[model samples]
Target: MACILRGLIRLSGLDKCINLVELNLAGNQISKIEGLEATLQLRRLILTSNKISAIEGISHLSRLEGLWLQDNRLASLESLALPQLAQLPALRSLYLQNLDRLAPNAVCRTPGYKAAVLAALPNLTNLDGERSPAALNYAELAAEYDAFRANPVPPKQWVVPDVAPWLAGVSQEVPMGGGPGEVALQQRHAKLLPLRFGAAPCVSGQVVKVIDECEMLVRVLGEEIAKFGRQAEARKSSAVAS
Candidate 1:
């Protein structure tokens, strides 16, 4: 038999009919379902856009080549167990569309969603229109829709914990004599050390001043040492007076 059971429901004995190839139960209102394994030879099962939200009973149809599931309230497709369908040796195509809950604008716009779906379903070559869901211009529309849906942005938290520590330490005394070059050096170190330590450390002004005074002292001492060397005899007489 090429076909059988055009609209049979709750008939447990229909399982004995193994020669059936095509079964069409489009509008039987057969919401609750079980036991269709008798039709093992079935190739095409047309249950398109029906109230069958859970495709649990259809898993045993190993010979099924095509399934039409569209225009349904299939919110959680992740729950639908179609592992066997993916492994179907003869199955070439599977159609699932018109899911009401999933926002058409959101799914098409978000790059993250598209990336996740493509990674999950490699065999699913086409969705909505393009070959890859990544090509959709959903990001823009989704941003607008999300802004409309979400609550207004809260005020800026400038006095948060991250800045609070710095605020408390800002009043501490620090060295006062560092020159521009020394201060610049300390600031540069401040930026670089933060990366190495993975956090910024509090720097004192005293250390900065000390750095500048040291630089000035080095310059003055070097000039005195050079001039003293040129007048060793005069330096000896001066030392006697000391």
Candidate 2:
């Protein structure tokens, strides 16, 4: 049975079909290859026109013979998870062409592309719809590829301004008994202050306002209770005298 273009984000709930074979999940949003570890009988698997970025999590499909992955977002051959594919002894045919995100001069576009793939998967008899020929001299190419993988250039770091010192300056301005100008200044700019700098600039004033409001409400309630008690006692005394 084939399931194509189902708009599935994940390959869940398919593990129950242990005997199922030939699953086709083409033209979907499946980004990862997973949830098919139990389908040991799966021979042909097609995942075309999807949002797949990496090629991991398919080592369990040991019986898979044919695999198709075309018109997806594969950026480079390194994302192919070649080491895992080597474990699939039955994998003879592989389709990896017309990848939307792969560059024109990408490693997959070079002459060594086929050689690298063949070197990685020695059992592959067909690749990208072409019949594999006699083994090519892929030693030098594989060595270079391995070296590049071993020592890739580190990614650049992003530097952002420190917000601690700026927050300290703002806190120092709010006195224990600040004047109305200071309070007004804080209130006016409190909302506009950039909170992304790892400090809650408006919290101090908000906390103070909340405490003051609660105290005022308690005082008002207490006064009302006292007034009610006095009126009740006066009415009882008046009734007893009459």
Candidate 3:
């Protein structure tokens, strides 16, 4: 059965659809080719108008007859070699049209591109909607493949500096007790202390009213503390009696 879907980042939950023969996911935000490892019966696979940067993880589709990957962000054919196109025994037709990034490269621009792809995958009879030419020599294709593989592209490297010592020095100044900022913040909070009854201390009125409100807040806090102390004493006396 054929399944036409779109706007999927990855193929995570489609493992149960093992019987699916054809799958089309045109115009999606998918970056990597993956999550279809269990679809062994898949023949026709289309992934057009997406953000796929490399061609990986499709070698597992042994039964894939036709593959379409048009208008993607693939930079080169290096990713195809890693998966080994020769591993796909049933691949016949392959489409890689409108690859803006790869089109600029000399390897992709020349007429030898078809020959290169044919050399890469001997089983491929059609590429980019064109049938393989009958007069194409196998010896020449092998030599081309050999020349292509002779100069290997180097993998990119990343170097990260150790900033742990610098971070440690800064952290030492702001230990568990906190730094000067924390002390200043505490003093500010004390000035605008909250009342026990879930209300901010009234400090916006006349000076006399503000002073009265502060005294009232102090009295309420003292009363609450005394009441808590009495309750604790009562609980202790009851425990002794029991």
TM-scores for all candidates? 0.40, 0.50, 0.50
Best of the two (2, 3) by lDDT: 2
Q: What does candidate 3's lDDT look like per residue over 1-242, in tens digits?
A: 88988768875677888998998998888888888977899999988778777788787888999888777775566744534667888988877763223322223454556567776777777666556633554436667878879976777898997765422312212212345654554444443333321354533223234445666798999999999999999999999999
State the lDDT of candidate 1 residue by residue for 116-154, as single tens digits.
544554565454333344455444566777897797768
Alpha carbon deviation, residue 207, candidate 2 (Å): 99
lDDT score for residue 73 of model 2: 70
Give the whole-model CA lDDT for all candidates, comma-separated: 0.55, 0.72, 0.68
> Model 3: which residue pairs collide?
none
- Give the residue spans of candidate 3 off by over 4 A: 98-107, 133-242
Best by lDDT: 2
Query: Tens-digit lDDT track for model 2 on 112-187?
Result: 6767888798888777655552344344456788898999979999999766654453543433344785587567
Model 2 ranges with Cα > 4 A deviation: 1-5, 98-107, 133-242
What would you estimate as the lDDT of candidate 2? Answer: 0.72
Error of 2 at 214 (Å): 99
- Residue pairs with colliding backbones in model 1 are 109-138, 109-139, 174-205, 174-206, 175-205, 175-206, 177-209, 178-209
* Model 2 TM-score (2 dp): 0.50
The 10-residue segment of model 1 with minimum total lDDT is 99-108
Preferred candidate (lDDT higher): 1 or 3: 3
